[model samples]
Target chain A: MIAMPDQPSRKPLVELRNLSKHFGEGQARVDALRDVTLTICSREVVGLLGPSGSGKSTLLNAIGCILEPDQGWMRLDGEVVYENRWLRGNLRRLRLEKIGFIFQTHNLLPFLNCTDNVAVVLHLAGWKKSAAIARAHELLADLPVDHRKVAMPGQLSGGEAQRVAIARALANRPRIILADEPTAALDSVRAGIVMDLLHKLAVEQDAAIIAVTHDEKILGRLDRIYRMVDGALSS
Target chain B: MNLAFRDIRHKLGRFVLTSLGLSMLLGVVVTMAGIYRGQTADALALLQATRADVWIVEAGSHGPFAEASRIPGDTREIVARMDGVSEAGSLTLQTVQLVQGDRRLRLQIIGYEPGRPGGPATLIAGREITSNRYEIIVDRQTGLLPGEALKLGRRTFTVVGLTSGIVTLSGDSVVYLTLADAQQVQFDLAPPAARREQARGAARGSTDLVNAVVARVSANIPASLIAAEISRWKHLSALTAAEQETLLTRTVIERASRQIGLFMTVLTLVSAVIIALIVYTLTLDKTRDIATLKMIGAPDRTIIGLIVQQALLMGVSGFIIGTAFVYAFRGVFPRRIEMLPADIAGLFVVVVLVCLAASALGVRVAVKVDPARALAG
Candidate 1:
C-alpha cells in the first residue's frame, strides 16, 4: 500500500500494490500504468484527476475487473482477487458481486425504459423480476429524476440519463463503484448536483466511490483526491 | 424480460415489414414444393380413377402416359377371354384443345365403355354418358355444366355429366366419352387433311385404334402373371398397374420433378444467406448495447440467446405467413398445390435449421465484442 502521510485509518474497501500494465511489444510498447498503489476505505468518495491519456481510464478499468494488470496484488473488501494473476476463475461473477461501473456517457439500453435500465443489473444478479423492479423503483425514488422513471433513455436529458445510470450502478449494491467522467457531459451546476449525489450515495450505500475525471471544479465534493502523471499516482 | 422481445417491440413496425418481405420469398419456395407434390398427386390421381389391374399396350412400348402405345380396339375382346381376366375395356386417349364460347380449353379426352373399369368412377352432377356418340362427361374444372354443348371440331357433344378431381398427368381436366366417340375424335381427320392425304395416296390411320386395353384380374390371381402371359404374344405387351405408375413417376416426369427440386434448393440457400445478412446487420447496430450488457456481467449465453431468439422469431413468422399465402392462393392456381402434413412439418424443421445457421454470424460478432469498449465511450 502507498504511504498515507497524515491520513486517518479506516476499514479498507479496496487495496492495490505494485500494479503495472503495458500495451504492445518491443519499441512499440507503451506503459499505461506503473506500480500503482492505493487504498480506499468504505463509504469514501475519491477523485482520480489526470490529464488526457495519463492512464486514469486504464486504472479505473483495472479496478473495475475489466482489465488485467501484468503484475499486481489487488484486494476488494479484504479479499485478495489478484496476485500477479487472477485468483477468481469466474471474473464476471466477481465483478457482478463486488464491482459497479458508471460509464462516461450514460450507456443505458435504448430499448428499455429507465426503470428497466436500473432493474436489469439486479435481475442479472439473481433477484426475482418483480423484486428487482421494486428495488429499482426505490433507488430511483431517491434520485431527482424519480418522476421520469417510466421514461425512455431518448426522452431524458443528459443530467437525467446520468442519474438513471447512477441508479443502475447502485442497483446491484456493489461495495466498489467505479465512475469514469460521471459528470463530464453536464453543466457546472448539474455537475455539482451529480457530484453531491454521488457523495451522498457513497455514504448511504456504504460503498467506496473512485471517480476518474478531468473536471477539477467538482473535486471539492470528494473526501480524498489522487493525481496521476505518467501512469503513476501521487496523493 | 426477454431482451430480444424488447428490441422487437421497440422497432415493431420495421420488424413486421421485414418479416412480410421475407414471407413472400418463403412463399415462393413453399409453393414450388407444393407444385411438385401436386404433380406427383396428379400422376397418381389418373391411375386411382381408372382402377385397372393390367394394361395390354403395343409390343415394345412403355405406353401410354410415358410413351406412345396403340393396340387394336378388338384386343379388349381377346383379353377378356384370358383365364384370370374378369373384365376388359379399350380406352382411346387423346389431348384436344376445344373452344367453348370465348375460352380455349385444353382437355384430356378419355373414351371408355359405359360399364367398363376405364370409365369415370364417380359423377358429381347430372347423369353418366349413355350414348356412345356425341355425349361427354367433363370435369368441373372445365367450367362446362351438364346440358352445355361442347363443340369439338365439326362435332357438338352434349355434356351429359360432370366429374370432379379427375385430372390428367399434366393437371388438365378430363372429358370422358364413349369408346366410339373418342376413337372418332382421335382417328378421324378433318375434311381438308383427309382430301390432302387422299391426293398423296396416304391412307388414314384406323379409327379402331385404342391407346391400350385395360383389364381387371381376379383378386387371388396376381395381375403380374396375366401380364407375363400377354408378353409371350408377338404383337402385345402387358403392364400391371403398379409398373405403369412407376414408369409415370420415375421416367415420364422425373426431370420436371428434379427441376423443381433444384429450384427449391437454390431458394432455400438464398433464403439462408439473406437471413444471415439481415441478422448480421441487426447485430452490428447493437454493438455498443451488447458491450454494455457484457460489461454489466451478463453471461455470454445471454447475449447468444438474444441474437438467436430474434432470428428464430423472424424465421417462424416468415414460415407462417408463407404457408398462409400458399393456402390463400391455392384455389386460384391453375395446377394443384398439394402439401401433406409431413411435407409441411419437414419444411418447418428445415426453416428452423436455416434460421439457426443464419444466426451463427451474429452470434460470433456478439460473443467477440469487447466489453471494455463500453467504458471507452
Candidate 2:
C-alpha cells in the first residue's frame, strides 16, 4: 500500500497499514504479527489487550520503530516514516525525537536520581542540562512522588518509582508513548493512579498512548481497546 | 550527567578498591623498573668516576666487576712508557664482609694510587687519603664520618674522606685505600695458613698483584690505539673506557636486568588482564541499564564513553598510586631505587594504551546489547 497524505485534522497521530512480522522461515516459521493495522489519534489512550504468546508487543514494537515490520505503510504525525522500509535515515534519532517508552518494571537507571532519570532523556535529545533538569522537575511536580524527586531508584516505593518512570516517558514531550504493561507490578490502587496519570498526560499534552497489557481491570480506563490472538488483531 | 562517574559514584567503594588492587600490581612493576635503573647506575658509578681513558688487566679476563682480572702491579709502569699515554695508576678491587658493631657489612674495597687516573675525582667530606697505609675514603652509605675509625683485615683504618652515591653493581658501598694497603688486606693469610704453606715448602705468592692498570691518553689521541698496544703485551689485556663501560653494564648485570624486565612484562600483562576482566564484569552487571540506555536512543558514543572512561580512570589512578608508592618507600628498599619523571610519563602512556585495549572486551559486549530486550518482560 502506498502512503498518502492525510488532511490535517483527520490525520492520525500514528498510522499503520498491513504490518506483518515473522520470526523464522520454513517449517519453523512463527508469525509474530499478521497483516495487522492500527491508528492512534492525538489525545487518545488506546490499549492492546492479549494473553501470553499473543502479538500485542510485536505491534507495539513496530509502531515504536524498534523492529521494522516485514511489510507496512506507516506514518507518524503526518510524516510517512516507513514504507515497507524505514524512510528515516537514523532510527535512533527518530526514536529519541518521536517516541517514549515505559516498561513493566519501571526501568529507571539505578544510578540516576528521580529527576536525572527524567532529565537524561531530554539531555540526550540535545537539551541543556539546566533546562533539561528544570523540565524534569516540571514533569515530576504533578506526580504523587514529586517530593521524592531527588531519591535514587532503589529508594523509591513501587508507586513512586512508576511515577518517576512516567515522568521520564513524558520528558521529551514525545508525540507517542508506548507503555508495555505499565502497571503490571503495581497494586490495584496504584495501578488506578498510574492509569489516571497516563490519561491526564495524554489529553494535556495531546499525545497518543498505546498500552499493551492483559490487565482487564484497567480496560475501563482506556478510550478503545484492540485484542490480539495468536498474531492476529480484532477490534 | 557523566554516566561513568555516576555509576562509579553509586559503587564508589567497590570501584576504589578495584583501583587500589590495580595500583598494588602496578607498584610492583614500577618498583622493579626503579631497581633495574638504580642497579644500572650503581654498576657504572665508580667506572664513570675513575676518569681513566684505558684499562689494562689480566689476559682474557672481564674484570674488575664481571670476572676476576689481575695483572702485575709493575704493568702500569710499562703502559706509562707507551706513546700517547699521559698518566697511569695501579688499581686493586676486592669485596670483603666485615663485622661492624653487631652486623656484617659487605663492602667493595677499591685501592688506587693517589693523584692518578684511577682515584675518585672529588670528595664530599674532609680530605682524600692523606696517609697511605691506614686511611680510607668511604662512600656515605657506610655511615662513617670524617676521622671515624673502622677496622678491616686486622687493621683499624681511619676514614679521612667521604664520597656520596658510590656503590658496586650489587649495591655494595665502595671504599678507597692506597694500592699497597688494599693488596695487603686482600692477600694476607692467617697465621695457621702461613704455617701450612711453610710446612708444605711452598713459597708465598706475590702480593703485588693489581686488579687493573688504569691510564689516561693525551687529548686528540685515541685511547683504543693505546689499549691495542698494551694488549699486545704477554699476559696483559687492555680495554678503552668505552669498552670497560660496556663490559660493566652488559656483562656484569645482564642476567638480573633481563629477569627484572621479564617480571615487569608479566606484571604489566597481569594488570591488563585484571582490568579487562573487571571492565567486562562491570559491563555485565549493568546489562539491563545498558539496554534501557540504547532503547531510549542514547548515541553509541555515550555507551562507548561510559566503558572507556571507567577503564581510563582505573589505569590512570593505578599509575599515579603505583608511582607514589614506589617513591614513598624508595629509601626503605635494600637495593637502591630511582624514579625519573620522563620514565614515569612513558609508563603512564603504556598504561593508557593497555587500558584502552583492555576496555575493548567491555565495549564489544555493550555495543552488542539488544535494545529490544528493554521491552521484554
Give the best candidate by lDDT. 1
Candidate 2: clashing pairs of residues? none
RMSD of each: 3.2, 4.1
lDDT of 2 at B192: 74
**Residue-level lDDT tens digits of model 2 in B1-377:** 89999999999999989999999999888898899989988988988889889988899986577778978888889888888999999999988888788767889999989888788778998898768699999998988898788898778899999898899988899999999888888865335787688689999778888989889999999998988887787688888889989987787789989999899999999999999999999999988899899888898899999999999998899889988988999988888987877778878998999999999999999999988888877
Each model's lDDT = 0.88, 0.87
What lDDT tens digits, residue by residue, belong to model 2 across residues A107-166?
A: 999999999999999989999999998999988898866799899999998889988998
Residue pairs with colliding backbones in model 1 are none
The DockQ scores of all candidates, in the order shown, are 0.68, 0.64
lDDT per residue as tens, model 1, B1-377:
78999999888998899899889888988898889989988888877789999988999998777678888888999999999999999987788876778998989888899998799888899998787689999999999899999987678899999998888778889899898888777645335777688679997666688988999998799999999999999799999999999988898679989999999999999999989988999999999999899888888988999999999999889989999999899989999999778888999999999999999999999999988889876
Model 1 lDDT per residue over A24-54, tens place: 8999888899999999997788999989878
Q: How high is each candidate's TM-score?
A: 0.94, 0.90
After superposition, candidate 1 runs with Cα above 4 Å error: A1-9, B189-195, B200-205
Positional deviation of residue B324's Cα in model 1 after best superposition, in angstroms: 1.0
